[model samples]
Target chain A: MDDFKFPYFFNYPPYFTLQPVRDTREKQIQLWKELILKYCKHHKVFLINLEEEFPLFSNTSIDRRLTYESREVFLGALVSEGRAEWMDKGHKKCLILWRRIQDWADLILEFVHEYGLEEGVTTLEEIRTGDETQGTELAGIDRVVLVKALKLLEQRGKAAIFKGTSADDEGVKFSI
Target chain B: MRRRPGISGLQTAAATRDQYRSLGENVAKIRTDLMMEQLSIFRSQLEEFARKHKNDIRKSPAFRAQFHSMCAKIGVDPLASNKGFWAELLGIGDFYYELGVQIVNVCLSTRPHNGGLIDLEELRGLLSKQRRSSRDPITDDDCLRAISKLKALGSGFEVFSVGNRKLVRSVPTELNKDHNQILEIAQARGYVTSEEVQVSLMWHSGRVIDTLETLMKEGLAMVDDGHPDGIRRFWFPCVGSTSGAVEAGSELSS
Candidate 1:
């Protein structure tokens, strides 16, 4: 296995503990905050196991890992800002509210709207890996994210994306 | 912990009964003197702001009303927690004005942040430019005198009154040296992050008067020609103190 290394800020003591200084904490929050979103997005991580030792949660070379309380606080900050969501009442499984359900759904509608695919239907797998969605926000988009976004447009009576031939062949049919 | 000075040479409160009795007189004297000078400065600053931003001034009735309400409630116009709110409510202009004035209300005193003579000059400059001016009806001297009557109002006013957990005098002069050690013991971060200190002292009218009086007589911390920022701030301006720095965070919740 390759040796692991932490970033420069990973060695900063405040990275592990909660910062109380308003200004310092703010900057710290910005750095951690952006990192959280970026890391999750890159890994296509839909869920963050809060109780388990996630690699992103720690930097062993620097001997620094976020405390459970700090983890909760950072994640809580995300949840508050609508960037992430709690999957359960216990908050053990955070269905990373990344990209926002509305926004993800907007992506689908925009694809349909832009491509003029209003009456056409496309499979969910097709959306997850279609040439049309390539390099767009929709490419490699989480299945849950796709469903939620489509559901949002559905509520608006704009389109419908749902189950197709059996359980695996789900698709969308845009009413518009 | 004890606010009263406890130097060895200084007579103990009990031992110096007569001196202690005079202590009340001394506090009253200091308090009175500080108020007069502070008020003169306050009125002049207001006049200057009114003069300089005449058009924006006229347009910002809602923002002004919000400021007035905050000032009335706690002698400080409370700043909105978010900059977006300020932009939406007060317009994108005058962020410095919002921050400056609110800092006065919070850290400084009820006294306006400028001197009367300076304000008169600012007002004069505006008038020279041929602009309509506020008939505020009170000269700096008149306002100063009127506020001198409020010399007692600033009494018992304390920074600890501002709610940080409503922890009375919970603010320490310095961050705990152990903060670094605690961080080391706790998490993964190890880089040093410096804090940003913002400072603006607003003197109460009563305090202004007292400053003026004191400057006339004993000559207290009078470095910046009647501007309390110079004296109270010990020269560095606008959040320079190593102690007063607060941590920075994201500009947006998003």
Candidate 2:
């Protein structure tokens, strides 16, 4: 990562502090909103714990970390823009929807189609950890996000999740 | 012992300059070449005459009497008697050219400029007057209305001062510098002309200001720099000694 020297503005002090001035805040919010989404999409990061140190929230060299309030401000801005969401009321866990939740569900449907899994039944565990998804972006998917995408498909009556034994050992049947 | 808010026309001046220049060029183009040459010659001759009398006009008792009499008719203070050397070089040849003015106001005030308090009643009354025009017919009213709101809410605000008295903080103060905030927003939203102001207004009242500020900060709506053909480029918000960078630096340290 050091090889990719960040832009000069990365060193700008205010760039780390969440701006409160409306005009400045709008700009800072925009840059962060874009940067956060870009970073999450690249790393395939789903949950962002505001309590923990995320690389996007901390600049080690700068000795700066976004305060919890700043994180809420940025994430709250995203939620308002429909680009992200809070997983719970505590506001501690966030689901970074770099891509819209709808888009993610669409991607899952497309992936199922590409693998000729249309009308096929597969164990939920197999779909997540099996060799087919090993090298794909779907391999390390968050359980909540996967359930969400499956539920979206189910809403359209395209697929269904059935109980097997436990929560981890579930199965999905698709009707094409 | 007070500093007044910087004049509103930093943005307005940019527009007025372009407008005046374009009008000057158009007038020059429409007149015959011979007429232009003759006018130029007459102008030079007038300058020569003004220069010759510059010294005499200041020191000569006879000339001072006439000068003061002429100034009295126009209600201007008499030119200083000591106006010597440098005044001759500049020459007053353009005196008779007949400049036009859209608005002019003169008044006396007892209010202290740096009181950190703005008399809301005075500001509201001032903005509601016809003088608060944009000089562009379209958004002239909108600009006035915006100013009106700013006035009621407090236009040149400082921390609430000693009870009722308002202070006129230095123009560079962060809190008082927001008069140009609207311009900064407009620039960022890409409203390159007066026309864009109307379209952007469709979103929300705040939208116009947001775009204006963006432009000013990014130096897009800067006068004579971007969109030369457009009139919106005429207004600039950064005119005083303090600049966008200075404000940014102070904020950075904070």
Candidate 3:
């Protein structure tokens, strides 16, 4: 995370401003959208609270900060591109989807095939924090996103999600 | 001769006028033939020079410029057409045609960042970088000539002077004196303040805001509103410190 390098345009002062011109604004928004997704994926950050400080939104060297309206515009563009989603009606929080849900589902299937867990039953908690999932993309996945992906697999008859004896122990039974 | 004065004298006068007319016609034809012979000699000498120094003309921009001037003196346009004897003998027409294509590419690629107006020197720098594989350096003179050729497209590609600096405008944006003055002032720092423009140009706030806003609308200027001094700064990416900033940023990332 500390070794992450921003693009050259990060130092540009105008990048912090919402451009008034049509073509320039479009380019600026596209760059911002890409940088945001990259920064989020590198840090494993699934949530962006627009109310709080995000390092990518400002450059101290140039003394430039994105105004609140500008931040919404950039994030709005990301939402329209299906790369991000607003967490609230007020747009104070956003979910960064560096990897789309379908792609994540495909990764999970690959992981199951690699570990020979075709017909094994494993708890949701165990899948997230277990040694088998260590050092993989699924190790620190957000619970909400993981459940959605598991549901997609369930619809495809690849797995089943059932409640265990206790509510905390939800299990996933893989069919193949 | 005195006895036959009236009729014989009139006939003699008519005969003398006809003889003078024939002599004048002969002299005019001979002069024209000599002029044609001299022009042909000049053409042959030009062909000989071009054949002798074809490499110099192709490799060195200064040498090529000198050769162009020589052609101009003789009322010969080597770049006038791309398929005549000059094109076949010197390939100078294709040389300029290639340069024009590269120039347009650089302008189009950098237009998003520079808002379609770039400093002439900066344009040459970018042009050379793109043409590095060819090993032929481009000069300001060459750029001007190539750009002038672009005027036939009538697409608003032009070069103009502002505060002793030449700027190549790729768009049809009209910039008045106030806009030019602001661009000139921003060339020093890459950013300007309304206060600076007002004090330096001795204009009131209304005029300053109007001009700067027009630039903003055209995408030629970007506004920074987060300074601690609470003053809005308008930055011009087409002028001032662009290369230095790019180098510094690359150093940080690398």
- Every candidate's DockQ is 0.05, 0.01, 0.47
lDDT tens digits, residues A21-138, model 2?
4555576677678878877887788899998988777665544567788889889989899888789999898998877768767877877898788898888777678888888777
The candidates, ranked best first by lDDT, are 3, 2, 1
Q: Model 3, A1-176: lDDT tens per residue? A: 36677675677777777777777789888888888899889999888888999888887777778889998998888899888889899999988888898888998898899889899888888778999889998888877678878999999999999999998788999997
Better of 1 and 3 by TM-score: 3
What tens digits encode model 2's per-residue C-alpha lDDT throughout B190-216? 224444554644445475556545444
Model 1 scores a TM of: 0.40
**Backbone clash tally (model 2):** 28
Regarding DockQ, does 1 or 3 come out ahead? Answer: 3
* Residue A174 displacement (Å), model 2: 0.6
Clashing pairs in 3: none
User: What RMSD does model 1 have?
Assistant: 22.0
Q: Which CAPRI level is candidate 2?
A: incorrect
lDDT (10s digit) by residue, model 1, range B1-254: 66756674366655688777799899988998898888768756655654565545334645455444544574533233335433334442343343233222333221111111112222222222322353322222222222222233443222211111111111122213232122222122111111111111233345444433332222111121122222221111111111111111111111
Model 2 misses residue B103 by how many Å?
34
Q: Which candidate's DockQ is highest?
A: 3
> Which 10 consecutive residues of model 3 chain B have the lowest summed lDDT?
B240-249
Candidate 2 has a TM-score of: 0.42
What does the i-RMS of model 3 come to?
2.3
